[model samples]
Target: MSASPWLVGPFVDMLVGSGLAYLMTLPLLLIISVRTGFVGWPVLLVTLISILVSVPHYGATLLRVYEERSQRQRYALFAYYLTGILALVFLAGIYSIPIGSALLTLYVSWSPWHIGGQNYGVALTILRRRGVEVTPLVKRLLYVSFVLSFLLALLSIHVENSNHVPASGLQAARIYRVIPVGIPSALVSVVFPVVLMIYVGSVVGAFVGLVRRGVRGWPLVSVVSLVAAQALWFVVPALLFFWSGTDAEGLLPFAAIWISAAHSAQYLWITTHYARRIDPGIRTGTYLGKALLAGAFVTIFPGLLFLPDWLGAPSWAAGLGTLLFAVVNIHHFALDGAIWKLRDGHVARALLRDDPGLAAGKAEASVGLGRWGWRVVWIGGSIALAVTVHEQFERTVTLSGITLRSLDRARDAIARLEWTGRDSDSDHLVLANSYLQAGNPDAAEKEYRESLARRPSAEAVSGLAAVRIQRRDWSGALENYDRAQRLDPDNVDLMIRRSDLLNQLESETPPVDRAAIRDLQRRSIRLLERALDLDRRRVPTIVRLARVYTRSGRRRDAAALIQAALEGLEGLASTERAMLEREKRALSDPRSGSAAGTRAGPVRPGASGARP
Candidate 1:
């Protein structure tokens, strides 16, 4: 007997299998909403979706592997040995950022390909079910199109966002601190467009081939929808990044959230179908309940058990979670690949046809646990899930408050988190930044010290420097700034800040002490020149350097710098352009002297004068 053309009919298959047409458009719309300030609860929403949809999908794979004794024995190497290895890796990753980042890199690199592979399998299954002969040429064409799509998306992510660092709170940005994997912009400029064109052409060729081979109706719709979803997920965003010449930091998180949710739902839809068909006695709810629990157990429970102390530290938690996530996904990818091959006679018989031959061997009897023992197990699982959910809820509130800039709400959430013993270095740093923004330099300094005590990062030291600047402890501020620069020598912002401080000190020096003033100017000049060397397009650095040149009696050099800035005026913001024009006028007027860019007093940290 032939297998049904549709799994649970056309509507369900199209909605779940193709992951709904809206799945393609929703990410773009949501990203726009977030960017425009229309959405404020994105973190909360994505977290909930992850708990409900994404986590359970991982459970589906576990159920497929260990639910039956015979299946467990068949895949023992993966189900037991490989899982044990991944567990050890996870433990190591909690302490070592490099190991954790390597694990994350593997998962990130493989994620798109895994999505493409699944879609490719589904499209082929649909075609076969519709009675279309899938020739080797047709298979090759489809395979190439999907692979190209994944490559296009992957390249776009690395290329377009190469220079854009996300907010410090984000997981990607945190990992990038240890492992910088950004591709060069010049290479992205050359390669992305070529790959995009080839991907588009391959997709079109595949569609035409399918049509020529008598593919029609739901099968064609499914294939077309899958291709469109791939494009929406990967290609369109890349195109947007390429066209706008902006970072994808705003869009990437939303895209990842929705795409993962959609992918998980699609996986569950097919896997559940397979499970029910292969074992007629299995109820859908029972199978899904087990899958959900198993998924939560593998993904969440282990983290809680092994890294209880690290949960409060967002940096450590994020890294550990990333490592755990990578391990689970790698295992899922490997096991799913092994079990779901259409080339396997048993898999083909079970999925492509309603054949019970695959289930002829009886499943091993359940462990003879008494009712009380079963009840205890369920109770323990429930408590674990409840704890996980509550932790997630607190995290969501804190992250939401941060994203929305609701300082009061953020403070309250942070307090609650710390009250629960979840206080972390990152949390303290965030509090310090909040205090700084609120103009409480003393409080900000205290928080910064607290953060540094837990973990000494450049950001924390920089925050302390800013606090000292606010208190007018110039020598103390310089000390902290020097420490910060030592931690991050290549940071252009730090170079500019230190230069600005020197310029302020020069303005304070008595005119009679020309040598001392000149020495300060020279030091400032060297710092600005170094900043310019690091980033030639940094207009602020160029403008600042020109001001120093005018003060140092290099009127010709200053005028030339101002002229170069004006030549690229179109790229400058209106304020930047106005500043440059004023500098040009000052350079032309010999009587203007040091009035053009000299600060009368110390510029506040993050003020226009400090940066400009």
Candidate 2:
């Protein structure tokens, strides 16, 4: 290969297989932001760019499917649209928030598999293009790399979320409900390393086959590039986010942006190639043609499909915005799967260019399970794996109530496994809360302290403060809250909690010096005022803050706060409105003002006061 091709080949492959367009755009955008000293606009810019690149691909595919009736049957195309409409209707009319949440969960869970499938397909395509003969064992190794990596990544996330993993002996026994077989949660925690090993093993295995059989040059490079790209795209991103110790939930949007960009680019590359092959005169490869087509499809089509989201009405309005968006995605997945059949003659002609070596490789891959014994074993193993996963999930759901006999076994196994680093701050916060719920204040306090030592996280500080409050360490609680407020001063909940904590301290303390007590009460009023400034329409905050104001001889401010809350209470539930009304009544009534001040208690941050 020429030096230019050697240098540029990997990048060219990326453009066709998984566009690094967003990757390129993002870094450049960040550089500009650094220079200009404005970060928010870049975020919006990147979002718009992602939508422009991704939405068009979906639109273009649907438009092609609709316009090119010769490539696809009429009924099939009609049914595709019908399915989307039905999905939207179901999502819009019958879908509760819980149902929508469930669907979103399912979508997120399935996404890794879908993305992995694409990566595997691209790898296979590269292997074929480079004239590498893919054997049955080679195919299995490749598939295992993708499957194991995806599963390990998924399981790592699960373990992080639940923090309870069984090791090899008893814990594994309890977890799997099996003897002599076990996979430890600690092993799951090392999923990143395991995934790397699998990918490396597959690459080594492929290279060894090539060396023994005397295939070198571009073929070896092709295999390596495929493996490297998969690692860069999937493995590295997951591990980077995982090891960062921040909430992995936040990484979803980042993953979606780059993954969608890759998927769109790959789909467009192949589809445009097919289009060019079918009709040379149509010229989808040209800049203007692509722009006009992609632009038109984006403008005219998806808007009509996703009009509900665009309406921007209230939550109670006749809108299925989320449903429509999700329906389009699911429908797109199904439609793309059905349409892009490489086995078809036209597709094979376009993709394979009638290469006999590639064709033979494809045949060998399909014939892997021709033997009945092998098929039986494969089927049995798959069914067993599925059952094990299902049972584990069921156990997790009922873990709080049910005590499985084997759980002790699993716990013992988990306890024996050696951990490497300290738990993430988020994990510590979660464990602290869980310990608190289980009536273990000591453990909860320790976890909170450990979390704070690692990072001055607002959540951890707030949790630590709450623990101090439970232990009646009033000064300690106030100090923690002050530390937390410095970290996240705008967090209304933290402010309200601190304000309430001050009130509780005041109520519990006997008045040694009335002036000192009044100073403390004034501090509470200021904290609540800051919270109100941050979130003007929070009725509960208004109520609690108003109560504080009334106690500290600011009844006029309390009355004004109640009036402002009432003005913004249109969409609140009846109970919520009623709660606010009670606050309104207390503040308005001259007789109850003194009573409201003396009857102070801790406000539960996110919840309303109980008839006080």
Tens digits of per-residue lDDT for model 2 on 1-612? 111222124665655564445455555655655576543333333434434555556655654454444433533654456665655654443335445534433444455566677666666665665555678787777777777656654554354343211110111111011121234657655765767677678767866766676766655555555555555455655565456654322332333444556666666665665555455455554522343344333322332333222343112112232333444555556666666655565555655563334322222211322456334433443443333234334334423232334333333322221021112344455556766655567877787776665445778877877777666676787798888889987888777777777787677767676786687788888887888788776777777878878877788888887777778656877876887788887777788763355546653421111122
lDDT tens per residue, model 1, 111-177: 7788889988888877776788877877887888889877765765466344322211235334423
Error (Å) of candidate 2 at residue 67 is 3.1
Per-model TM-score versus the true fold? 0.78, 0.48
Of candidate 2, the 10-residue stretch with the lowest lDDT total is 167-176
- What C-alpha lDDT, on a 0 to 100 scale, does residue 264 get in candidate 1? 87
Q: Give model 2's TM-score versus the native structure.
A: 0.48
> Candidate 1 overall Cα lDDT vs. reference?
0.71
Question: Candidate 2 at residue 165, lDDT?
Answer: 17
Instruction: Give me the overall lDDT of model 2.
Output: 0.54
> How big is the RMSD of model 1?
5.5
